[model samples]
Target: MPPDSDGVPNKTRRDFLKKSSFLTAAAFVPVTVVNAAVNQWDEKLASVFEKTSLHLEVNGLALNLSVEPRTTLLDLLREQLNLTGTKKGCDRGQCGACTVHADGMRINSCLSLAVTNEGKKITTIEGLSKGQELHPMQEAFIKHDGFQCGYCTPGQIMSAVALIKEGHAGSEMEIREYMSGNICRCGAYPNIVNAIQEVKTGGLS
Candidate 1:
C-alpha cells in the first residue's frame, strides 16, 4: 500500500487491478462471441446428415452405393471403384483431365455430382476396350504416339469416342477445335490430331 496525501492510504494497486480486469474482459467480449459463433456453425454443419444410395452403370458394371450428399462422381470412380484412369489434374472444371462420357456426352467428372448421376450411364476409359480388343481411338493413339506422359490419354480417348459418335471428325481443324479441352502438356497436339484423323479415316490398325 502507498501513502496518499495527508497520510491517507492510497488504493493505486486496487484501482489499477480493477481497471485492468475491466479492460481485459471488455477486450475478450468480441473474441468470446466469435468463438461461440464458430463453434455453433461447426456443430450445425456436423449435424447435417446425407447418406443416400446411388445406382449407376459405371464402366459397364451396375453399381449400387450409399454415398454422402457432397461426394463427387469423380471421387466415387477414383476413390471407390479404383478406376484411376480418369486423372484428377485440376479437380476444378477448367482442366479436362477428368473428362468422361455421361450418357454419351462429355462432362467434367470432377464437377459432376454423384447424386445427380444416379441411374445414368457413365463410360470411362476402362469401358472403351472390349475383351482383348482395343477401341479404334486407342489403337490410333498408340500408333501415332499421341501421348507422351499419357495422363490425358483416357480423357482424350473418351472425348474422341464421343466426338466420332457426334460426327465432328470432318477435318483436321475441326478435330483440333473439338479436342482442345483435353490438353497434352507434352506438346503432342500434332500426334494427337493425326491419331484422331487416322481413326476417322480408317488408317488405324
Candidate 2:
C-alpha cells in the first residue's frame, strides 16, 4: 500500500475508485455549455420583444421613433402622431380610409408596415393644407360637396390629389376606376367626380 493509503482509515480501493470515477465524469460534464445555452436563451427572448428604431419624415417633419415590429403605418400616423385625419375605417387593405402619400405617391397606409417605410417621406391628410388655408383639392371638394359623413373624405381627397397628379383624371370613367378603392358610404360619387374634374381643370384657388 502507498504511504497515503496507510494514513487513511476504512477507504477501500473499490470505494476510492468509484468516487474518483464520479469526480472524473463530473470534470468532463461541460459546465460552460450549460452557461452558454442559458445566455443564448436570454438573447433570443430579448430579440423577440425588442422594439426597432425607425427614421422617417411625416408632413415634412423629420422624426426618430421606436416602434414595434408589427405596427402598421396607419396606426403610427393616427395613434402615435395624432394625425387622426387619416381614419382607420377597415384596418384591412380593402377600405381606402387609411390613404396617405409616401414620397409623393399614394398608398394604403393600413397595408404598409411602419418599419418598412423607414426613411420615407409620409404625407397624411393633416399635411394637405397650409396653416388655416385649405388645399385646392379640399376647396374643390367643399365646392362640389364631395363628402357627407367626412369619415372617408380625408382619404378621398388624398387619392384625388394623387390621381390628378398621376394624370388618371383625364376622363370621368378613368377617375371613377382609379378612385373606386375609396368608398364613401354617403353615396357622394357624383360630387366626388365633379370635385376631381374641377381640380383637374385647374379651376380651384
Candidate 3:
C-alpha cells in the first residue's frame, strides 16, 4: 500500500486482512444455504437406500419395523429394538458375540440380514429367563464361572442352549466342535465347557 496524501498508508495491514477475509468468505455459498443443501442431499441419499418392511418376534415381543436392505439382524436388535444383550463384536462372523436364535436355530446375527428373517421368532439373551429367574443355561454358566471378562458370556450361553437342544453336547469334543464359532478372549473355555456339560446332563434346573 502506498502512502496517501496525509503520509499514512492507504490501508493498514489490519484493514487489508479484514477485507481479504470478507472477500474469501463471500466467494463461497452462504453457510445457511450450504447447510440447507447438505440436509437435502442427505434426505435424497436416505431415500435412495430404500427401507424394507421387517416383521418378526424378538424376545417374544412382536415388532414391525422398516429397515434398509443392508441392515444386519444384530443392528436391528441392538440399535432399533433396544436389545443390547446381544453384543456386537468383530462385526464380522468371526466373533460369536452377536449370537442369537432365529426360529429355534442359533445364528450369527451380524452375518444374517434383517430382511432375510421375516416372520421368524428371534431369541436373545434377554429372552432366556422368566421374571426374577435365570434360564438353566444362564444359571449353569454363572455356577461354573464360565466367563471372566463376560463379553462373550451371552453368546456362549445362547450357543450352549442350542448345542444341548441340537444333541451335539454328547461329549467334550462335541461341545468344543459345536462351540468353535465362539471365541473367548479371556480364555474361559474350560469353564464354558463345564457349564455346557452340566446343562446337557440335566444337572441344572
User: Which tens-of-lDDT digit does each residue in 1-205 have in candidate 1?
Assistant: 2235786654354455544544554577877546645565433433233266789999788988877767898998999889999889889877688999998899999998888898999999988889889988999999889899898889888888888878998999999889888887888889988888888887754
C-alpha lDDT (0 to 100) for residue 134 of candidate 1:
94
Model 1 lDDT on a 0 to 1 scale: 0.81
TM-score for candidate 2, residues paired by index: 0.77
lDDT of each structure? Answer: 0.81, 0.85, 0.86
Model 3 Cα RMSD, 1 decimal: 16.7
* Least accurate 10 contiguous residues by lDDT in model 1: 41-50
Kindly list the per-residue Cα lDDT of model 3 for residues 115-192, writing each as its tens digit. 999899999999999987999998999899999999988998998989999999999999999999999999999999
Candidate 3 Cα lDDT to native: 0.86
- Rank list by TM-score: 3, 2, 1
Which sections of candidate 3 miss by over 4 Å? 1-49
RMSD of each: 17.6, 17.6, 16.7
lDDT of 3 at 66: 86
TM-score against truth, every candidate? 0.76, 0.77, 0.80
